[model samples]
Target chain A: MTDVKALAQERQQMFVNVYRGKIPTRIPINSILSLEACIEYAGANQAEVLWDMTKAEPIFEKVNTDFPADTPAGGTRRYPSFYQILGSRPFVMSSEGVMQHPNVQGMEPEDYDDFIAAPYDTMIEKIYPRLYTELDTDPNTKALILAKAMRAHGDEFALLAQIGARMRAKFGFASIPSSATTAPFDFLADFLRSFTGICSDIRRYPDKVIAACEALTPILIKKGKLPVPSKIGVTSIPLHMGPYLRTKDFEKFYWPSLKKQVEVLTEMGINVSLFVEHDFMRFLDHLSELPENTILRFEYGDPKLVSEKLGSKFIISGFYPVMLLHTGTKEQCIDKAKELIDILAPGGRYIFNTDKGAMDMHGNITENLKAVIEFVREYGKYDNPDEPYDLSKDPMPPAEKIVAEIEANLNSKYYQTWEQYRANHPELEGRPQEVIAKKIKKLEDDMFNFIINLGS
Target chain B: MDRLLLLTQAISDLDEEKVFQILDELIAENPSDEEVQEIVAACQRGMIIVGELFDSDDYYVADLIFAGELMSKAVEVLKPIICSRKKDTIGTIVLGTVKGDLHDIGKNIFKGMAETEGFEVHDLGIDVEPDVFVAKVKQIEPQIVAMSAVLTIALNSMKNTVDALKKAGLREKVKIIIGGNPVTEDSCKRIGADAFTTIAGEGVDICKKWIVNSIA
Candidate 1:
């Protein structure tokens, strides 16, 4: 037990050192086996495990014991029972228990005006029922089912969170605090408009798409803000739809709001990591404009060019393709890791990881994965481990400018203002009122996030 | 510029409104069957320009998709004339997203482009199994069989499908192409596919080269 505690302390400290802009003894590998992968590794049925995550506790332990990684086993980001109760069209569980999100339309083209006018309200009133057909029933039945779904969602996540905390203790997994949000355009594209719908709407109704993204910007920022900001704790933004758009369309529709979100989040001392999906070789200039020390994980790009252009300012990771682990020899996998480490590990801003998480054991062989991770731990050492890079020198945008942007896009029409609520509760005052108000604000924020984050 | 060139330019530019207006004007003229075929051919040429623009990064997948929709609309406008005149399709293709993979956007894009280029496409839809593909190929005898998959697991399905074709003694009759995000020079060889590409335009070009060579 003491040895595990010491190991946890050691791994956590190494993560902290790298995140704090200090050169650690070696490159820290932050790979997490997906729950599906763990389930497969344990030979448990995926559908059975998903239905009752408690059934998979032994599997999680086996994963930790077998597949050595710096991070704990990833829990369910998509809970099937919650969606199953809602008769969800957006998130459907396949026969194999894999949750699949086929393209779905929550908002029609004509609904853009309504959506842009009140994004949250439109989501709750129009989009929710459209996405979850059970929510489209009679008012009484709708409320019952919605409450049941929410309860299921909460119960599932609460159990997963409990298991995750347990695994951290058992395995000495590093706690690099993490939360996730998608880009505004991605949220809009993924939820309100289907992929095909968005592509057509971008051409058929360009202005409306722009206005809709603008309307979504503030809400996404609110969604992105960490409850407790830490420089070492990263807010992950899994970027989608950027690579598929031309550079011109990308700049116009995608970059501005996402760039602003990153600027705002980073300025608040919360580090941001973008899972840069697909090849983003063309957008290096725009990416360079981001604040220094931001983490960029590329799925596909020229590693040498990315290292040359963005390595000095940003923390670079994720050019090692997971596919090679499935197909290549162990030596070939290690050679690829060495190649990426050579290009990206210089100047003290590289974290070793595969380009993507293994969805299941099929995409990667265990021998290759074990070999590459061990190789990185040994071969990625720095001669001088105590050198510190000054991250305090990272510049932030003007405080007033950030405040103004926040103020301008606050879609207050969608939520009940605090002032409005306070006026109605005039009898209560002083510290008691303040305490109650804080609790009420947290509830409102929770509900807001629940509505906004649906289908993303 | 002539109307065909103008139509071509509008499509290349992705001017949806202008494309419809020009198509509507051309339809009202009650032109000969040959002239109508020329108009359809003109729209096809416009899609080629779209493909070129996409390759150069001036356009994107969204642009290609939008252009496809525009082409469909243009085809709808010329459907009457097209029906009146019968012509041989350049070739036929058996296409699918392969087993265990439900992603169809890329497959759909390639189908639209191939149909626009006058290939008769037999789309097997998403999550199509190996025997289904084998059955279709044995039934229709297409010049080419194209498999698409986005998931890495589906690569195994691609190989299985190819192996099934070989087992059924149908592999020698048709050319095979595999495409999607996970495909590379290595996987293509392992899957026993004749060719592979990530781009829909490039895939169509490969299909055309095969047909053209076969004819020669």
Candidate 2:
């Protein structure tokens, strides 16, 4: 048997080396294998699988072992063994055949008043009781059972008694530390608020909304400090397109807290990974403020822009849109891969990955990864004699010239007013005109500021 | 003086602290609901500007969320008086996160918006069971029953809740709306939901339309 500890050490070293600007023998491949994939692959009945975790465990184990291509290897591979243990606690399926895993504990309280009013032990009493009971009954036995299940899966699984020990040492356990879970903001907005309510609140009671977020941050950070079984830090923040708060609003509510969270985790030596879901190209400056070593995993944002602006500072994990994986042929995938490699792989701070998870048929992950590997093998060399690419070839005209263009565009009688411009674009009808004007002014102001700052 | 234009300027600047201070002076001066709504429209303009900034790459997600926070605060000060003479209850909404799903941020945001729009929202909290939903519907006789689930696995619970509501003979009486990360319009139709919104802002229109149409 291969020494599990030794293998883990090797993988860790490789990761560190890559982060430190050293190229390993081969590019590391890491992917998240959804339980949905396992169930679909195994063709197991959902109800039956939910009833008995042991039954599902074998199937997950089988699929992982058989489909090495699908599984994320190298680094710490925490397989899908826990699915069987958690069982099905309801909220498993939607009317549309979409599967979901609800938290065993229900939604959190709505406002700060509700949150503060609730008992401190509510989480312990309502949520973790059963898990604690099981632990109390046989702590070592349970750990051994989980360890055995992990070991049976081969080199992919590494069992660390507590996942965020390193983070705990650094951050002192005040922050929530669950690497595999979604961020509290996403959990609240996507799962709890529904769409309309969150949107309305964005307009109606924005302060209360910000207060609620502020209140949750400490609690979530505290939860991140928990002891769990795993190596390698895991944290996920889901970015959603929204009811549309303007830039100033974003700076106030979202940036400070997100920056704080990233800073806390990175300070404690936790590998921070963010998954950007929607188009957030507008907020590059805010994103650039994150800790330098943070790993940015983009789902929808443009790769070229990301690489140019943020690539040098952090690890650029993905830019391959899932749509390409489905619609494009293997050759097309390879071409795209080569293009991305040529642009992003320079300076050794890039890791090839899909824009998002290989969810549904759109992401033919096998072909995609294969293409990435092939391209890396062929062209991902640091010592190759290739000309350094210049990103700022066609720079924008001077700020004054740009402002002139804006004025000319605004003045043309073709559209009487900004409202007329919005009317021409029906999609813009739903959005408020004042908001649009404000955004335009801010952009113009920022451009002017940039120009001013450059002169200074 | 183009009150709308002035309001828009205030909103665009997100001069909430300034707006609130001005609002306090206005309230002391006994401003009417129409005047407040006009100002609120201006605040809405600020939100729109931010949204555009987001689209044009002038702002980021954090910027938008922060703007959302500011807008909500500004709304709170104006909501009471603006909505005072208006109908006390546009409708009651019994909402919750499905059982086993611990996400409630979306639900809370929705609740805040609903309340701001003069809807009485009874939030059942996250990981709510179908039985609990049924019980709440029976008690509240809510005009709408909204459900949220972030995870795909929790979607079944949403279906179960709807099924339970139907079984309890409460389905026809209340409109069922759903939203979340994994939920799509097709999923809403598949789950037998009355409507599905991709974002919380859109959900308000869906609920309000249902209520107005039903009442008419």
Candidate 3:
């Protein structure tokens, strides 16, 4: 039998090599599978799998074995007990195989002081009651609830560890340390106030927001520095609220906390995989100021320009659009994969990933993704990927020209889409074309321009 | 100075205090119906400007919510005569976040915006069961049903609500709308909704436009 330890060591090294800016023998692939997608593939009952996780192992085992990932998908989603115990009002566990996040604001704007002063204390005492209405019961019952929750969480984590091991044993794929944490501002935006709430806070009470973020910096930094019990000593950070804000606002409101925490993580020799969600083309320069060896996963920014601007400073991944896999022909998908490989794989500090993470088999053409991944592994084999590519023929054009091209594409495509939508729905049949056209125009002129000028 | 213009500026500026102050001043004066009509028209005009500013990046999703809050205040102040005119309300809307999904950030904004756009809105907070929706539809017989959800799981709940409405023979009576992050244009068809949008404000606008066309 092949040694599990050997298989794990081999994959870990490949991952290490990519982040270290040294090309391994070939490319490495990790699966970013969500639990909802897993259940769909298995045809398992959603409520049974989500709420009662003991019934979920066999399904995960089959799926992992079927699609043997080089690095297994980290962080199990079968935490129903933990959620139930915590009275996590934000997340919902329905029988649809999909976990839902309710848009309840965990922390109000006025309560920044309490949060800033003592995060752990406030989260347990104040935030929990507000977030989970069920937990707002009398103190004695609340304590009992907290006790049960804490106990349930222990079991949940234990089950998750077992599942992670099962995948490694059965599929020869080990899980990496998943960072179950976020930057202070990201945490605030996502968990506490939400995007709308934070935006309002920024506009009205910029100082309080800034100060609160600053105060949370040490706490966040300590969390980043803490070791995760996994194969590789790496951390994951998903970024939001940065792309949506103006460059000035991002600089003031978002970056300080993130930078401080990241720098400490770097100092502590822990690698970070920062997933830049939505388009962050405008803030590429500001983000590039981050330390070398930081893995940047982009969602929608231009890949060629991304490599041009931030590639030298940070190891970049994620430009393979998931839509192509879902909709395009196999060849078309392969060609796009090849295109991403051509742009990014010439250097060692590049990893292969989708623009969006995999949620379900429906959203991804299984065969296409498998084929492209296999092809890229062979295609990306390099003696020295650190050697720069020759970019003489098709160099990047002016930013304005690229912006105009994007606008042209949007206007034409959106108009066609608008026509299609109208025909499909009877209500839009006699509606003026101007309504949809105006939306497209706004995307082209106002929104796009605003994003572009954020850096300027 | 035209009070209508002043109201419009106050809304555009997102000056909640100024809006309420002006509205109170107008109320105290015991204004005529023509004057009240002008004030209502100005509020609508201000909401449109708010939408415009949102598109321009001068405002954002939060601003839209804030504007909705302002509009709700204006509506409360104008409640005496808001429903006095038969056409004062463009249409009646039954609004709620679907069952098993307690998300109201988007729903709250939609309620505020729809109310501002002169629709008589009945907001069913969140996690509303399909039967409740069907029962409400039967009771109120609203012209439009607007559902908001941020979870894919709730898509099925939306479908269940649609199915419930159909089961009660009330599907044809109301045009349905759904919006949230998880909903796509395809979701509109899949869930048997007439329209779908991601933006709460835009959802309100779409309903307003449809009602306007049907009215014309």
Best by TM-score: 1
Candidate 2, residues A1-456: lDDT per residue as tens digits?
A: 345445444445445545444554334444434544555556775445533344555554554344332123212222333323323232234333334433332333344344333312332233222322332235566565434433443322222213223322322221223343344444345434433345445555667666656654443443333123223344555555331445666676566666776666554445567776666676888889988767777766678898899988887777776556655778887888778777877766766677765433224655555565556554654563223222235242232332233333332232133444455677765667688866764444333222111111
Native-structure RMSD, model 2: 19.6
Give candidate 3 misplaced runs (Cα > 4 Å). A1-5, A95-97, A134-139, A174-178, A194-196, A228-232, A383-456, B1-7, B15-37, B73-87, B98-103, B124-135, B149-171, B182-193
Docking quality (DockQ) for each candidate = 0.52, 0.07, 0.19
Model 1 TM-score, 2 decimals: 0.90
Q: What is the TM-score of chain B alone in each candidate?
A: 0.97, 0.82, 0.87
Q: List the residue pairs that clash in candidate 3.
A: none
Order candidates by lDDT, high to low.
Answer: 1, 3, 2
Which runs of model 1 end up more than 4 angstroms from their true locations?
A227-232, A387-414, A417-435, B134-144, B163-175, B208-216
Candidate structures ordered by DockQ, highest first? 1, 3, 2
Candidate 2: regions farther than 4 A off: A1-17, A20-25, A34-64, A67-280, A283-295, A307-314, A319-349, A352-456, B1-12, B29-88
Put down candidate 3 lDDT per residue, A1-456, tens digits, no spaces: 478777776666677666666766666765645676677778887667777777778877766666565766535633666566656666766534355665557788778887676554566566668776667999898877766765665566668778777777766664455443477787777767776677668766788898888866654554443223222356777787776676677888899889877876665555677888888887887788888888888899799998888776778888887767765778998899788878886667787788766666664467777777677767767776443222233233233333233233332221223334456667655667787755754433332222111101
lDDT of 2 at A39: 56
- Candidate 1 per-residue lDDT, tens place, B67-155, comes to 88898888888887888868689999999988877788889889988887789999999788899999999999999999998987788
lDDT tens readout by residue for model 1, A131-199:
998998898999899778777877887798789889899988776667678898999898679888899
- Which clashing pairs does model 1 show? none
Model 2 docking grade? incorrect
